[model samples]
Target: MIAIDNKLISDEVLDEQFVCDLTKCKGGCCEDGDAGAPLEDWEMKEINDHYEAIKPYMTPEGIREIERQGKYIYDKEFGWVTPTINGAICAYGFRDEKGIIKCAAEQAYNDGKLDWKKPVSCHLFPIKIQKSRRDPDMEYVNYEPREDLCKAACSLGEKLKVPVYIFLKEALIRKYGEDFYEALEAVAGYKKNND
Candidate 1:
């Protein structure tokens, strides 16, 4: 593990390879999960604030589910998460013409409807972060690509020689700032040179 500040990052971030193959997977990660994409407390407010602006990008069913379930729901196992359509796909996700699940919030953001992107959890997919159980102030950054959903990503990553951390550079920086990302990169560079 690479320790940085209050976080412990798993070695898999540098060793494991991954690059989302949207054509092959069709954004399965967005829809195949048992719960909706995880949300921070502030993200719930962002959804509530930008609902009208983002509603146009969302499916009718998603809007209805949001109305029925309230913007986000508290999960027993995962704390807060976006509401799903009847416990299926995320209510914020819409199936496109190519059958890929697209995030309405992200679409809205790209269209200049809101400043916030989709949930950080969604952006940082294949990599999950959680508060450390042993130390309340510490966090754990883990590489956790789904075996069934991410097979193509893994294969492509190997072909491209892109490490999991490299594949997630933007997301990591977005979530943890550039310092953390540089720290991870430095570790990767050091390991590569020594090995």
Candidate 2:
């Protein structure tokens, strides 16, 4: 584990390679998980504030689920999360004509109708955060690539020589700030030189 501030980043973040292969996976993470995308308090607030703007971008099923669930739900196991449609796809997710799942919130954000893009949890795919075992307050950055859904990504990453940390640079900076990302970059440089 690589410690920085209160977070312990798994070595897999440095060692493993990954890049989303959307054509292959069709955004499985948005629909295949047992729970919807995890939501922070602020993200919930954002959803409520921007629901009207995001509504038009969502599918009828997604909009109905959100309307029925009232933005988000409190899961016993996962704390706050976006409501899922029949315990499946995220309430904010829709299948495009290509059959790839996409986030309504992201579509709205891209069109300048909403300020928030989507949940940071969704942005940081394959890198799930957890509470450190040694210290509950400490965060753990875990690289959790899926075997079934991420096979193409893993293969592409290995072929391209792109590490997990590099692939998620933007998300890491968005969640943890510039200093944290720079620290990871520095560590990657050091390890590359020494190894």
Candidate 3:
């Protein structure tokens, strides 16, 4: 696990071309079973609203099953969390008749009907948010990306136009500090321009 400071990242990294090839990964992040990154009050509202709007599209049995599992409970000791709905498969994920796994929120995004603010948790994955006592600020931490998780992030990065380095930096800074970020920047530069 790596901690990253959100302030250390420059806008250049945010706009770079870091692509994730998801077709090769098959939604590993969705399968890792952890969702609901720590939410601020506003973020919670957004998630609740999105859940209400998307509730109709979900299978009733699926919703019941998730409820039965107590997936909605927020535990202070464990932090804001939820069990993966549908046996660790995302509720929004499904197979088409041809057997291609699809993400409903992504499809909605493509159709231009989805609220970008909704599902705030979906955007923050693998990278968990933690509060910093040193700076008294919130920080993002990378909790060991599974091989498949990296692939899924690669895919989402392509769709969202975010670089993996940005994610990495954010995670690193939250867990470490400016010096760590500088070290990572040097390493990243070496990798980018190496012979």
Candidate 4:
């Protein structure tokens, strides 16, 4: 583990190679999870504040789920999360013509209706962050490799020579700021040279 700025990063983040192979996975992460996308307290407010703008891009069922469930729901395990339609696809998700799950919030952002793109948790997928149980202030950011869902991504990443840290640069910067990302890059470079 690498400690940086109150966050502990798992070494797998530097060693592994991964770039989302959306064409192969078809955004399965949005639909495959038992609970909806995890939302931070602030993100819950963002969703409520911008629901109207995001509503048009969502499916009717998604809208209904959000209306009935009040944007998010509490999971016994996952705490506050975006509500899912029929306990499946997220309340903010809709399928594209190719059957790929797409985020309505992202669509709204793409259309310039909102500044926030999807939930930060969703945006930083495959890289999960957990607060330290003891310290609370410290976080552990780790690369979680799901072989079944991410095999194609692994293959593509290896083919393209993109490490997990590099592949997730945008999301990491979004979560931890540019300075943190640069620090991580420095760590990656050092590891590469030393190994």
Candidate 5:
């Protein structure tokens, strides 16, 4: 593990390669999860504040689900999370003509209707965060490749020689900060040379 700022990062983040193959995966991660996308308190507030703007981009069912669930819901295992439609696909998801699920929140963001680009948790795909049981302030940030859904991404990453950290640079920087990402890059370089 690599210690950076307040988080402990797994080596797979540096060693493993990954690049989302959206065409192949069809955004199945948004639909296949047992639970909804994890949410922070602030994210819940953001959704509530911007629901009207985001609503135009979502499915009627998704909007109804979100309204019925009231922004976010708590799961016994996953804490606070976005609501889902029929206990599947995220309430903020819509299917494209290609039969792939896409994020409505992101569509709104891209359209300049909102500043928030989807939730940080969703932005930082394949890198789930866990708060330390031993130290409340510490977090474990690791690469969690969902093999079934991410096989193409893994293959592409390896073919392109792009490490997971590099592929996820924008999201990581969004969740952490530019300095944290710079630190991560430095560490990745060191690890590459030392190994």
Candidate 6:
């Protein structure tokens, strides 16, 4: 399971030998299918707006592709209420000159033409933030330091250089609040067994 929290973990632990070897596996995360995570109302709105803005650049087939997958519903209390699509890959997924899969969103962002309202989930790859089903108010676990398994399981893992925990904390705090940062910190520390 993916870990989500606001507490900061020591970078030292992050650098520990326990970190899984990622090179052995392909990026299963990018290619296997759509891995659903929650989204806020604002998040949904952003994604919709982006889709509209980029609609001209997108072919009808592209639009239909995403539409066929359906949109994710959001709930105030529950956060992202549903993942209506299956095998949902990001709009930006493509191969590079080196034959590695790269995110189009990142490329667009770098190109300075990306719609800021795109779903945060679209940009936040590998890293995921989920509210605890057992305790919605409480953030979930911090780090899922299973790079080896993740790389093996996720087809896009090879290109996913950033640590999942790092991305999750940064994305959550940016989208949510400082509370999320604190939660991530705690979880990071815990993952290190730092107490």
Per-model TM-score on C-alpha atoms: 0.97, 0.96, 0.54, 0.97, 0.97, 0.52
lDDT of 2: 0.91
The CA-based lDDT of model 3 is what? 0.51
Model 3 compared with the native: what TM-score? 0.54
Output the lDDT of residue 65, model 2.
88
- Could you tally the backbone clashes for each prediction? 0, 0, 12, 0, 0, 30
Superior by lDDT: candidate 2 or candidate 3? 2
Please give the lDDT score for candidate 6: 0.46
Which pairs clash inside model 2? none
Tens digits of per-residue lDDT, candidate 6, 135-156, equal 6575443334345445452344
Q: Clashing pairs in model 5?
A: none
lDDT at residue 164 of model 5 (Cα atoms): 92
lDDT of each: 0.91, 0.91, 0.51, 0.90, 0.91, 0.46
lDDT (Cα, tens digit) per residue for candidate 1, span 1-195: 999999999999999989999999999888788798889888988988999988998899998998898889988888899999877889989888999999999999999989998999999999999997788889899999998889999999999999999999999999999999999999999999998
For candidate 4, what's the RMSD?
1.0
Q: Give lDDT tens digits, candidate 5, residues 1-195.
A: 999978999999989999999999999889788789999888988888998899999999998998788678999887899899888899999999999899998999999999999988888889999998799999999899797899999999999999999999999999899999999999999988998
lDDT of each residue in 103-132, candidate 4, tens digit only: 999999999999999998888879988888
Per-residue error (Å), model 5, residue 9: 0.1
Write down the TM-score for model 6. Answer: 0.52
Task: List clashing residue pairs in candidate 4.
Answer: none
Worst 10 residues of 4 by lDDT: 85-94
Q: Which 10 consecutive residues of model 3 have the lowest summed lDDT? A: 1-10
User: Model 2: how far is 65 from its true place, Å?
Assistant: 1.0
The C-alpha stretches of model 2 lying farther than 4 A from their native spots are: 133-136
